[model samples]
Target: MGVIKKIFNKSRPSNEKDGIFFDEMKKLLGFKPIALSHYRRAFTHRSSNKTDAQGNPINYERLEFLGDAMLGSVIAAHLFTEAPTGDEGYLTKMRSKIVSREHLNELGRDLDLISWVESNVAPQHFGENIHGNLFEAFIGAIYLDRGFTYCEKFIHKKVIGPYVDIARLEGKVISYKSLLIEWCQKEKKKFHFEVYEDNGVEGQKYFGVRLKIDGNVIAKARATSKKKSEEKASQRAYFALQEKINIK
Candidate 1:
């Protein structure tokens, strides 16, 4: 069944030159591919305004959903099989940490997924989530194009093997705010965040914050809301404490 799909894909014409996509795909995937359309759609950003005959948008979003599921399933299975002594809560948190958005964005950025996006929207304007979204979408494309076994192979090779560093990531905090709070609490320091209205960007309400620790203004940051602003402020504080923090 998969072989038949491959032949049909080979017969199809592409606006871009042949072998170029295939070769690039090989380098990116670390293996030569039998079909190219799946990758083309994988890389195609929603901004391109493309759709298929069934009126389904020919973007990576749907595939991203599928890939996200696949990733979660695979990661869960790995955790279950390997960590025999780990409890459910431990496994769940570990899985969440592994599949976190920040991690996914890092993977996508490292893979240079942005270069292949076919968006009408300027890549510069994209939000932080774009990288993670595209990464998931790319996974979806691989799953559909090659089926489950190959999808597992790709995820294991690209995601699990290369990126999932267990011990290092275990001590990592996905939220800078939590780390900052813990530091303040442990050091017995009086810390507070002051938020002020941005009064700019009519449609979006922005907030600015200053994180003061031990009567010392450690960082100032801004974001769409008070929470985001505080998180950003906390992140700044964490970076400022680069030399001090245990980072464990």
Candidate 2:
């Protein structure tokens, strides 16, 4: 209570905009922030060209790195406690599923974290990965302002409580491409993903991939990038050969 009051006092907004931000952050975090500056830094983009008094760049990249470490540590500890029977490999894989880029991006989108971004670049120009980046930077801000206890609490409330289902996660496939490759290796079958062609209009180019298995084309797919096209092709191939692959 005393600490909360002190933090609230220290973080009181001096202006209308600051007040709105403070309230919004309080709503998002479920607690008043000790230092609003950390979150401001979290939302700062490199394109904004922001710098601190000492001429150090001020952007969310460093906070994203810190938050990533914090997320891994907290999630790992939870997995360690919850899955005692899981080996190192199993634990690592499960953690990956929970903290997957897709999952983080979903979380960020749900929270509408991107709305707070301070960037010179237009929002339409930002890629899908920016959502996940903002989410990680937000976590980093929580860690900086409130410490590990608050960080753990926020993650638990927002992440673990809702999404960390062991049974569901165990069956979730993080990468169909990896799964297809592993199945092929296990069955002693040669598999390849080849970029067959580039498609789409100017400024929206797409790559076409052919997934070949044992000299025959298993599946083909097109996407904005080679990696995405290959993944899509692998996914199609996996479904085409689902019975034969029999991933378990």
Candidate 3:
């Protein structure tokens, strides 16, 4: 009898940890999840090295891709309805602003979603981008667990309701670098972002960029990455030439 009981217990699934996860997810999702397995996959990091019976690796990357598509669809629909007068370019720009990676990272951090991640890598080693990736995965999980309606509702409640504002978003610049380049092209002025130096302590290195317009240095900036430094320089150049650019 003891041996039989032991075998039975060993084969049984544990509920204690899953119950805690369910409650936490309920609070975050604003509804009880019908399928917990999907949510579990959402929070799973690639480093966990988990796999399914079919030998397919399980992680949030696939979910993230699906969520990206869902988010684009829903946000595009909302933009279409809200801005009836907007042309294709206008609507696209607005949607981009709303679903920008920076905005997604902010949303994920607001929810403290990183706390639920399952991974072999230490939390401290993760980059800021993980937050946005997790948020997208969470949305993908929602879509799979409850369908499009529930997924749309979650996005509306968490993203569109709280953050999106048409007026504010219109003036928002998704990429100052792009804006600066456009302005320079229109004005028939040549512009360049040159890496001047790389500086910083061992683990933390900063790249310096100089923005030159028509052979004249316009702005100089430094950041952790060359791309970031170039963007910073471009932003500074834009502000400096704001009057000339006539940007609204």
Candidate 4:
């Protein structure tokens, strides 16, 4: 109780603007915030370089880590009960797909979490990952401010109920490169990915990948990383051979 009171007292919004902000937050969260500091830290970017009274660096990164674990735990439990017939490998794959970076980024975008971020850096300069990181940090804040039950409820409402359709998830491919490779091997098709360093605009070094199937270039792509370039190339290849890929 003393700790909770201290947190509330330390950063209680001191203006009408803060009051209105809390009201909006209440509507979004479905509860009055007991520790507004947690949510504030959740939305704070590392660019702010904030520190607590104890001089410990405070940002959303740590909260994001905790939230990731919480999300995985809840999702794993759900999968375990929903698919009793699934073996260890199957369950693990499903969880990976559900908690994938792409999916989390989508969820964060859906929530418009970026608008709430407090940062010294320009919002436009931030990467696509900022959205997902904020969402995870928000979940961590919820867990700390409320409890595991509220955290689970939020996950169920936002993640499980709307997004996690078991049948649809089973067919979902989290990595296009892996899927493409699997298809190639299964079809006994000779495939190779030749990756080369290709520097681009602003002198930024990039990787160019050309995907060859049976000695023919199926797709070519470039990205900041070899793996990303390969994945991009695989995505194009998957679309080109969508009919043969046998995925709907």
For all candidates, what are the clash counts?
Answer: 1, 0, 0, 0
lDDT of 2: 0.86
Between prediction 1 and prediction 2, which has the larger TM-score?
2
Ranking by TM-score: 2, 4, 3, 1
lDDT (Cα, tens digit) per residue for candidate 3, span 98-166: 989998986787677899899999987889899899999999999988789889999998888656768
Highest-scoring model, lDDT: 2
lDDT of 2 by residue, 1-248 (tens): 67765857576677898899998999999888878899999999899999989999999999999999999999999999999999999999999999999989867865779899999999978899998999999999999898999999999888886557686588766777898888889889999888888865677576889999999999987666889778767766776685565664
Best by TM-score: 2
**Span of 10 residues, lowest total lDDT, candidate 1:** 7-16
Q: Is candidate 2 or candidate 4 better by lDDT?
A: 2
Q: What C-alpha lDDT, on a 0 to 100 scale, does residue 150 get in candidate 1?
A: 74
TM-score of 3: 0.64
For model 1, name the residue pairs that clash.
47-120
Off by over 4 Å in 1: 2-16, 172-248
In the range 1-248, model 4's lDDT, one tens digit per residue, is 98865665455366787777677677677666777778889999999989999999889999999999899999999999999999999999999999999989867865778888988999878898988898899999989988888889889977886567676577656777888888888888888999755666464456789999999999887666788778778877886786465644
TM-score of each: 0.64, 0.66, 0.64, 0.64
List ranges where model 4 is wrong by over 4 Å. 2-15, 172-248
Model 1's lDDT to the true fold? 0.77
- Tell me the lDDT of candidate 3: 0.84
State the lDDT at 76 in candidate 2. Answer: 98
lDDT of 1 by residue, 1-248 (tens): 76776665564335467657776887777655666788898888778889899998888878889989988888888888877888999899989998899889867865769888888888778787888988898888877777777778888887776556454467655777887788778877788998755857666466789999887898887666789778767866776676576633
